[model samples]
Target: MDIIERFLKYVSYETTSNEESETTPSSDKEIVLLKELVKEMKDLGLNAFYKGGFAYGDIKSDSNKSDTIFLMAHVDTSPDASGKDVKPRIVHFDGSPIKLNENRALDPKVFESMCYHLNHDLIVTDGTTLLGGDDKAGVAIILDTVEKILKRGNYPNIKVCFSPDEEIGRGTKGIDLEYIKKDTDKIYAYTVDGGEIMGFSYENFNAASAKVIAEGVSIHPSIGKNKLINAMEVIAEFHDHLPKCRPENTEGREGFIHLVGMKGLVERAEYVYILRSFEKDELESFKNAFLESKNIINKKYNKDLITVEIRDSYKNMKEVIDKHPYTVDIVHEVYKEMNIPCVDWPIRGGTDGATLSHMGLPCPNLGTGGDNFHGVYEYLDIDEMKTMVQIITKIMDKLE
Candidate 1:
């Protein structure tokens, strides 16, 4: 199958995941695509199964070699925006901006610095919804590469995993390593899960999630002065006390406290936050600082206006990747051989590879040349994606 065709078809499925859902996939819609992948994998003559009712797809690669290679990609789109009814646009580069509409044009002026794509064919989203290229592109590349390998034969043993609900962050929690057989002997795993064409990643954030609950006494607004404490006010006060150096004023490589979600009123209000950093100690310090802030607020308010809860989500993968340097070295060598300039970059966000690395697979992420992921502005360099497919083919050959 053509990779672009596969990508378009995959995105056509509404797999946008919800972070609030308690289910395995976080969204029932994700199953629609997961099952489709299971069907496709089986049709390609690979041993495949959909575990937990389409929460994920696991397929064993058909290769004669003893050392196994695993390729991973997520099936979930971001819940930050709508992924439903996505209408993708394909441009043939006629030397002018591809008009998405009379009001909106797929021009570099609006997308800013997109002039580089003026001469190349590209795939973009309609103005209404996200294109879902983030991992769909990754999915297409993996599936197409697998089909090619199966047709060509004589390839090393391969394992393909299509995980669900990755966009909301629980993508790899249920992964069963026992099925892979070779365990640590599985040479090197790669996640085609990064963004843009610069395409190399071996480090990711040490992450944590937090919840703050503020309780107050409800009273009439006129009598609420000294007779009652407003929980919303307490929460606002807590927010005011948080460091200014936090998310409100930081970016790239610099960690911060992000206020992700907040709700409720006078009686009680809840605040949700995510703490991120590439350094474990730094993340820890950031968490500790929040704890200290909580303590100070509780004491100062004298009414238990705040209760802070914190939990570690995932750790940075650098420690494991650094130990198995060759896991990354092999990929760099392959990229160099293919003449694609490779540069190791830090992932500001997390990937399934981050969790897998700590789970005994030193997997790093590579790009499928996707940009502006998870929003209507999302697009992919079709040529770069094709190049990525060819690169994966070469990487598999080099592994042998």
Candidate 2:
């Protein structure tokens, strides 16, 4: 199948990962797509395997190159939106408002990125669910490239992995360099999970998460006075106490603390926050903001009513990528040869590349020609997706 055909097929699976689940894939539905990927890889004549939540595909090269290039994309969509029963259709985006449904429209005025997509064929979602183009597009590109390269023959050694729970930041849990390294002194890995056509990132946010729980005294509102401490009210006030460094208020290297999930009542409340920054120190301060707010709120209530738990996630890969310049050097040589202007985009979010780099792989990130990921408004530029195939294929052809 073509790239677009494969993408649409993969997104049809409801692979929404559960952050609450402690399992490796976090959701059983993720396995449906993972299993299908393994079958497809085997059909393509690549030695493939499916174990746990991870899928691996190996392409043998006739050329005995010293370097083994690894390409990766995640099968699971983001939990922030519904990935079930996705209804996708291709639209020829003009410079006018494109209707998603009766109530929603893809207007260039609202989403400025739409302006760039004029005269382009885009695969978009219905107003109800996300299109799942974020990494599905990445998946299709890798698999399609695998097929094309094998047919072309005499290609460099290529390895591909499709992971689960990437949106929840658990994609790299079972993935390591040993399997992909196989008889090569140097490994060049790239995570094909970035957004936008020009996005090539070597850096991403240092990330962590904080879960806050507040306990309060409940009373009948009619008979309530100072004795009544609403847990919901306490949680809201605790949020207010922190600096206004929120996702909406920050951009482009300016870190933010974002509230991802919340549930509460008068007697008990819980909220989860994702803290991010380009700098380690800044991320530390962001984590501290949660503790500091918990203390202030607890002190204000004169009770130990608030409790917080913070856990560290992946760090920025720039520190490690800098140590191995060859990881990015090949990308530069390929883009220069292809005459595509290099776009050094820094990811405000994290990727599998982040954790994989620290795990000794030194992986970088590449764009999948997608935009507005993890939402109903997400889309994939069909032409750009095809361009990505060319870009990756060229990189493989040029690999020494």
Candidate 3:
């Protein structure tokens, strides 16, 4: 199938991952797309399998090429918005807002990036759901590139993986690194799961998550004075103690503590926070700040009212990619040769590559021509998607 056809088919699966589930995929629906991708790979004459909610496949090089490249893209969409019954539409841009329905429209004025896509065909949603182009576009590009290379009969060995629960930061958690190493001799890898056409990322935030529990003594209102403590008030106080210039107020290289989830009653309350920073020391500082707030809350209550536990999620990939600069240089050279401008920017959020790189993969990230990922404004520039396919093919050619 062509890139557009493949992309549209993949998005029709409604593979939105759940962060609250305990299964390997976090949602059974993800397996639907995983199985289809495995079948597609096999039909194309490549070795493929669906294992543990992940789709894995490989195509051998027809030529005597020793270097193996691994391409990865997640099959799951973010749960932040509805992914069910997504109605995608194709529209030609004329430098104006594209109306999805009477109630909603994709405004270039709000999303200035749309200006760059003028005169290009775009795949968009109906404004009620996300388009899932973030990584589905990546999936189509990898599949299309592999098909083209195989038809031509000369290329480096290529391995493809479609992971699940990437939107929840667990995409690579279940992947067996030892098995991958035993299966192929990997020289380089990249996640085709970034935003924008020319934008590539090696640097991402050092991430961690924290859960805070606030305990309170609940009593009747008549006897509440000096006898009862409100957990909701304590939770609010905890939040207030956090830096005012936090995630929403900061940008570019600056890190902050973002409260993602909160639920509680008067007797008990819980808050989930994601802490991020570009530097490890800075991330540590942010953690300390939270700890200090927790300390103050405990002291104010004169009891252990607030308790917090923090866990590391992933580190910056640049720390690993820098060791193998040639991996990035190759992509840059290919982009230059294809006359595509290369934009290297720090990823404000994490990708599967971030965790995979730390696990001895030395993987970086490449763009999939997606914009406004994880929301209703998401879109894919068809022209840019085609360009990415060409870029991948050229990278493989250079490897040969």
Candidate 4:
């Protein structure tokens, strides 16, 4: 099948991960699609299997080389939006606003990135659900490239993995990297999970997530007078103490503290935040800010009613990519050969590559020709994805 056909089929599976679940994958639905991927890899004559809610595929090259090139993409969609019953629409852009549904339109004025895709076909969502283009597009690109390479030999040995929980920062927790490197002298990898096909990243944010719980006393309003303390108000105080560096306020290498979710009652409330920065020191400062806010609020109330928990997500992949310059240099050479006009963009968010690289695998990320991922306004440029398939094949041939 072609890239478009493969993408449409993959996105039809509802694989939104659950962060609250205690299970290995955090969700069972991810396995359904993962099994299908294993079957497809087997059909391509790849030694593929699904284990621990992750799928792995291996192909041995006829070339007498011990070097292996690994291509990876996540199988789960972001929990920020619904992935169920996604309705994908294809629009041939003509420099006009395109309607996605009754209440939503893919307006060029709002999304200036659409300007680059003008006069090209775009695969968009129906405004009610995310199109799952984040990594599904990456999956299709890898699969398509694998098929073509199988037809034409002389490529390096390839390893494929479709990891789960990448959306929730648990992508590399289940994989065995030592085993993947057992028989190989050197391994090179690319996580096909970035946005915009012309951009790739060796650096991503040093990331963490914080959870704040506020506790207060509750009583009847008529009799409560000075005795009642609203938990929501306490949570609000914590939110206000945070710096104004939010997702909307920061760009490029700037960091941000994003309030992902909050829920509360009169007596108790909680808020979740994701902190991101390109520098390790900056990320540390953000974590300190969370603790400082908790200190101030508890001092004011004269009670230990606030609790803070912060956990590291992933570090910048550049820390590892810097050691092996070829990981990034090889990609640039391939893009130069393809005349793709690629950019050395920095990732504003974290990916599976960041964690895997730090684990001694040294993987960089490639783009998928997509934009506005993880939400209703997400879209994929049809021509860009197809072109990426060829670029990936070129990398396979060149790296060998």
Candidate 5:
């Protein structure tokens, strides 16, 4: 199928993943789309399988080989937005900004990057819901590219994986990495999970989640004066200790300590934080800063009032990618050959590649040409999507 046609069909399914659920696939509804993709891959004369209710397919070349390449994309949208009944509208632009539904223009004033797609046909929404292009675009691109490779009959072995609950950050949770290990001899893979046409990323944040719990001594409001310990006040102080310059306000490779959630009461209070950075030293500094803040709060308030829990989420992929320089060269060469500007940057966020790269597999992130992900203004450039297909073909040609 054509890229656009594939994207249209992929977007039709509401594969929005759930974060709260403990299930592997997060939401069982995601399988609805995964099964469809399996059927489509089978129809294309490729070997496909859906294991553990997750959409995972392994496509091989005509010749059997000891090595392979893995191409991966997620199947779920973010639960933060409405993924149900996504209405996609296609428009060809000639430098004029696209107007969403009700004539609401996709103003470049807000999303300046939207202008990068000025001359291409775009698939956008009517502003009520997300376009699911955050990943469906990647899926379509990979499928289209694989189909072309299969048709050409000269490509090497290829492995395809469609993971669920990526938006919720559990895309790799239930997935057995052994599947990849047992299925193929390839130790390298690439996740098509980024934005921009020729974008390539190997550096991602070393992430950790922290929960600060404060025990408050509840007292009668009339007698609650100095005798009562206010947990909320202590929590506020803990929050204030974080430097303003260290927040998301400072963008691009900068580390930040983000307050993801907080709740407080007289009896007790709790606050959740996500600490992220590209450098391990920066991550350590952030953690130490938080620990110091906790100590300060404990000394000022009740020494036992504040307790901190810091858990490592994922680590930066740079160290692993450094060992496999060929993977980086593959990405850079593909962009150069296509004459597309290749920009390398560190992801403030995390990806499946971060964990996978550490798991004996060197995987990097590739752009999907989508913007404003996880929101109503999500969109994809048609020309860029096609270029991605060509890049994949180029990668295969180089392999041969």
Candidate 6:
């Protein structure tokens, strides 16, 4: 199947990952796509199977090359928008505002990148749902490139993985690293999950998640004076103490603490936050600042009213990518050979590459021809998607 056809098929399944689920795949719906991908891989005569909600496939080289190149993409879409019943529309851009629905439109004024896509075809949504192009485009590119490579014959050993729950940051948690290490000689992997055509990322935020719980004593309103403490008020005070210049106010290498979600009643309150920074020390300082705020709240209440829990997610992949410079150098060389513009930029959000890089696989992220991901404004440039396929083919051919 073609890239567009495969992408449309993949998105037809509601594979939105659930962060609240305790299962491996997080959502059972993700397995639908995983099984389909595995069947497709097997039909293509590659050794393929689904394990732990992940689809794994391998194609041995016709050549005696000792090195292996692994290509990966996530199958799950973000829960930030509705992925169910996504109605994708193909429109030719003439540089005007493209109406998605009565209330929403894709405007060149709002998304300046549409200006560059004038006269090009784009895959978009109906404004009620996200297009799921973020990593589905990546999946399509990898699958299409691999199929083409097999037909031509004579390529290095290639491994492909379609992971689940990437949107929830658990994509690599269920990956079989032992299988990866044993199948390949020297593995060099890249995740085709970056946005835009030319943009590539090796640097990503040092990420950590924080959960704060506020405890309070609830009593009848008539007798509440000086005897009752409102947990909602305590939680509000905690948020007020947080830095005003947050994620929205900061950009380009500046880190910020983001309040993602909050829930509470009078008896107890909970706040979920994510801390992001390029530097580990800066991330630590930000985390400490939150703890200090908690300390102040505890002192003010004269009791341990607020408790904080912090957990590390992933670090910048540059630390690992820098060790093996060729991993990135070869990609730049491949882009130069293909006359594709290479844009090196820091990823404001984390990717599967960061987690895998930290897991002993020196992986960086490659572009996927997607824009405005994780929202209704998401789109995929058809021409750029085709170019991404070419780029992947070239990388496979050039891999030693």
Best by TM-score: 5
lDDT of 3 at 157: 83
Give the alpha carbon lDDT tens digit for every residue of 98-179 in model 1: 6765566666656654654556678887777888888899999999998988898867777888888888778886776666
Query: C-alpha displacement of 197 in model 2, angstroms?
Result: 2.0
Ordered by lDDT, highest first, the candidates read 4, 6, 3, 2, 5, 1
lDDT of 2 by residue, 1-400 (tens): 9887899899889999899999989999989899999999999998999877899988767777656779999988888889999999999987887789998988889999777678999998887899999889999989988889888887887788999998887898877457877766667889887677676899999989999999989999988987899999999999998778999989998999899999999999999998999999998888788889999998888899999999987799999999999878888888888888788889887778888888888999988878888898999898888888888888787777
TM-score ranking from best to worst? Answer: 5, 3, 6, 1, 4, 2
Q: What is the TM-score of each candidate against the true structure?
A: 0.86, 0.84, 0.90, 0.85, 0.93, 0.88
lDDT of 4 by residue, 337-376 (tens): 8888888889887778888888898998888889998999
Candidate 3 wrong stretches, greater than 4 Å: 214-238, 263-270, 296-305
Q: Global CA lDDT of candidate 4, please?
A: 0.89
For model 2, what is the C-alpha lDDT against the true structure? 0.87
By TM-score, how accurate is candidate 3? 0.90
Cα RMSDs, all models? 3.2, 3.6, 2.6, 3.3, 2.1, 2.8
Candidate with better TM-score, 3 vs 4: 3
Those runs of model 5 whose alpha carbons end farther than 4 Å from true positions after fitting are 63-66, 183-186, 221-226
Candidate 6 clashes between residue pairs 3 or more apart in a chain or in different chains: none
lDDT of each residue in 270-338, candidate 5, tens digit only: 999888888899888888887898888888864778888999999999999999888889778888877
The digit string of per-residue lDDT tens for model 6 on 194-247 reads 677788788999999999999999999899999899998998898888776588
Q: What's the count of clashing pairs in each model shown? A: 0, 0, 0, 0, 0, 0
Candidate 4 ranges with C-alpha deviation above 4 Å: 210-244, 258-273, 289-310
Overall lDDT per candidate, in order of appearance: 0.80, 0.87, 0.88, 0.89, 0.83, 0.89
- Candidate 2: how large is its RMSD? 3.6
